[model samples]
Target: MAWFRNLSRFSTINVSRRHDPFLLSSFNCFSSNNINTNPTIEKPSVDPVQYSGLGPTKPHEKPRVVVLGSGWAGCRLMKGLDPEIYDIVCVSPRNHMVFTPLLASTCVGTLEFRSVAEPIARIQPAISREPGSYFFLSNCTGISADKHMVHCETVTEGEQALDPWSFTVSYDKLVIALGAQPTTFGIRGVKEHAIFLREVHHAQEIRRKLLLNLMLSDVPGISEEEKRRLLHCVVVGGGPTGVEFSGELSDFIMRDVRQRYAHVKDYVHVTLIEANEILSSFDVRLRNYATKQLTKSGVRLVRGTVKDVQDQNIILNDGSEVPYGLLVWSTGVGPSPLIHALDLPKAPGGGRIGVDEWLRVPSVQDIFSIGDCSGFVESTGRQTLPALAQVAEREGKYLAHLLNKIGKAGGGRANSGKDIDFGEPFVYKHLGSMASVGSYKALVDLRQSKETKGISLAGFISWFIWRSAYLTRVVSWRNRIYVAINWATTLVFGRDISRI
Candidate 1:
């Protein structure tokens, strides 16, 4: 239908597809296709390798590994590790991994939502193959560390009332990958009024709100004041998420929205507010460049902390108010409720769950934490690594390698109960950061060391690099093709303003 509306017009690259693993992979969690009535499912044929104390990691007898939250960290670890080694169980409310870096693109019609989302089953086939492995669509509510059990609640609707909706699954090794959520910082009404940018649903909600405002602006007999309010979009928190959304919104307004709603084009506006500075996490050069680029692209940058957010307006520290049709809260991430609920040590100031360099909870063995949920402790006195997808992915791969080494070394055994020796602590290598500010303009901040300054690149070249980098990072070829086609058609025909 409309998916290929103008696809024939552009000479598109044909992406070769990667087939899903043929092995009856255990796709637990929230799959409509593959659901195990029993949490303890049949195991796939084992790798024939032998083990002591714990015995060989068979589907039934292998050390049961439970991974919480299928974000970047959990997903990668599930993919990198051998199903032949550990019986893996993954639990999360969602079954899809939202390629977060390109999420803003989806909000403004630069890319379709499905293209950027990869189902966990497709990425982590090993999890599906593991016997007794459960793909649970649920939230981990409590962890009985003493008993090595995780208390979870099934969130799926339409289940039998008499059926067990909540249960505890015992784990030999537990992984905490429950990523962070939006922090309103106790600002009044923010929790209810402002939209967050943490998940796929957040992006969907933003898209709906954005289009709704546009439609409302076109309604007859609407007052100028109401129209102004309907068209005014405010983005809070000038981090990568906020800046990118503002940029994308700016692009939508200039490239598509303005042309489509020519009668009231000038009334539509975007304002981005930050407590300190936009892209404060980036190098100074890149941050400055982003500020200038966003301003040049007609996104008003307000350097002020938000004190309170009302349904109709945002209140600033200086007591000024800015009316808005849509308010997006992209403020820094905070620990999730599940993290706080655990009786675990938290990092200072940020309240993130603390983990040793091996990504293990120092006080609790067998339970490891990673990604945004866990703060890496450095013996070198370095700051905890930034909560980034790259960092999470790297940690996952490292953890997988460690698990492989441990499985071979017989570290994960029930009878012996020996501590696994992860010889080296995690060392993070900062690659670079990039943010697009509309109109094919972007900024890139390459890594820097104490001895030398890093390289900084901006403008059209960086934008191309941004596109190429994210394109290559997408997991599946089918999704890559879909995203490529969406981008091509958008450039050629502009965004289709279909609200539904």
Candidate 2:
């Protein structure tokens, strides 16, 4: 009855009675069945050839190339890639590419986490047919090299936490730029207790966990020893990440917590334990500078190997136990599971994939590997390029050039001369190393021959250089501005203690 009533609204009201005779005549003829039954065949419409939105590019256009990972290598490759030639697609688990150098700063509240993260979908050669063309395959599990498809499991935007959260994508040419992760070395308790500083999410989790520990230490019923343990932040590995985190943690204690929780200031401490002397990778001069600054900042530097990480303490190789509230492990990297799954040939010492000068896989000519995961040999010597943003960036650009060339040739010829041509063996020009020590001191290793030539920085000068270089290297103008604003705000009114 409701449906009929709703349909009743379609009654045709007569506006002009002058046309009533014609209507009545037509109705009468139909009632009398005087209509001739004819089989009328109607031709369907033939629309003229019209182009849709950026319709799959011209036939002679570049081949479909897909890049995996949005880290330093993948992002840079996409950035440098030519739009006209290759139909570019970037698939990664993370939607945003984190500028990992500044990740520690974000955790310690020196910078906003968002400032260090550049959305992968935002930066591309041009606004693609698909707005999210820099496709975020957040659930990527493995690669089907045989099928030339990325076996992914991704959730649509805003539905990540829900149960239905996995999808796959097909690709033509795939670039594996997936970087390395922190290696546990089969060490027990390392995986269970030690926090890592690999991504923006890790930084965020660490920040939240650190804040929680601080707040819980201030609880009324908690004992002083427990509070002490809670406030002691022990960092393993004296590399740039560990050193920077220690420095930032020290500053946080002295600057923010001391003024607010003066009683807890004495309890708060940061200790860095390294197998060897800190910053083992850096030049001795720079390492010494960093050590001196760290010591002066009241961070205890323990020179020995860590035997094990327990519930609330780190046991050193020398039979000494140091109680810690938070244990951060920034030790070293190993081959990612994805890379290892490929069963590619690896170097002896490190398990990084082996390649010749052009950056291609030894067996798989079309597939290219770069960043921390790739290992290339030179005519002069063998060197595994350290997993750094700089290295990844260069390799990515180089890969883009090779890919462009391959597309131009219409996939007729091999891009490089060697079976695994990793582009002239990727000689990493040591552009010096820098460590941010507490206060206004930062140790700068000026290995470069330019204006900053071999100068060690201390006080405000080193700090300025460190800030400027990192800010310059940050991905986008919007992100750089946000970081600058956060820095200015922190200087003016101190860090906001809000957590979400």
TM-score for all predictions? 0.85, 0.81
Residue 308 shift from truth in candidate 2, angstroms? 1.9
Give lDDT tens digits, candidate 2, residues 1-500: 21112112212211111223342332223322223243242221222231011122234544566777888998899887777765676666676789888888888788988999898656784524532234644545776555555655444346433222223444446678888889877777998988999998888888887888888988899998999899888898888889999988888878898887776778888889888878766666777778888888889988888887898877888889999888889988888777777756675467777776767666664677888888874432567777777888988988888777666556612233334332344455757777788786787776653344465555568888999999899989999999999999988888766667
lDDT digits (tens) for residues 220-271 of candidate 1: 9999999999999999989898999999999999989878898789899999
Q: Model 1, residue 352: displacement in angstroms?
A: 1.7
Off by over 4 Å in 1: 1-60, 157-164, 377-382, 414-420, 449-452
Residue 466 displacement (Å), model 2: 0.8
Q: After superposition, how far is residue 327 of candidate 2 from its true place, in Å?
A: 1.2
Off by over 4 Å in 2: 1-62, 125-134, 155-170, 377-381, 412-427, 448-455
Number of the top TM-score candidate: 1
lDDT for model 2 comes to: 0.70
RMSD of each: 10.7, 13.4
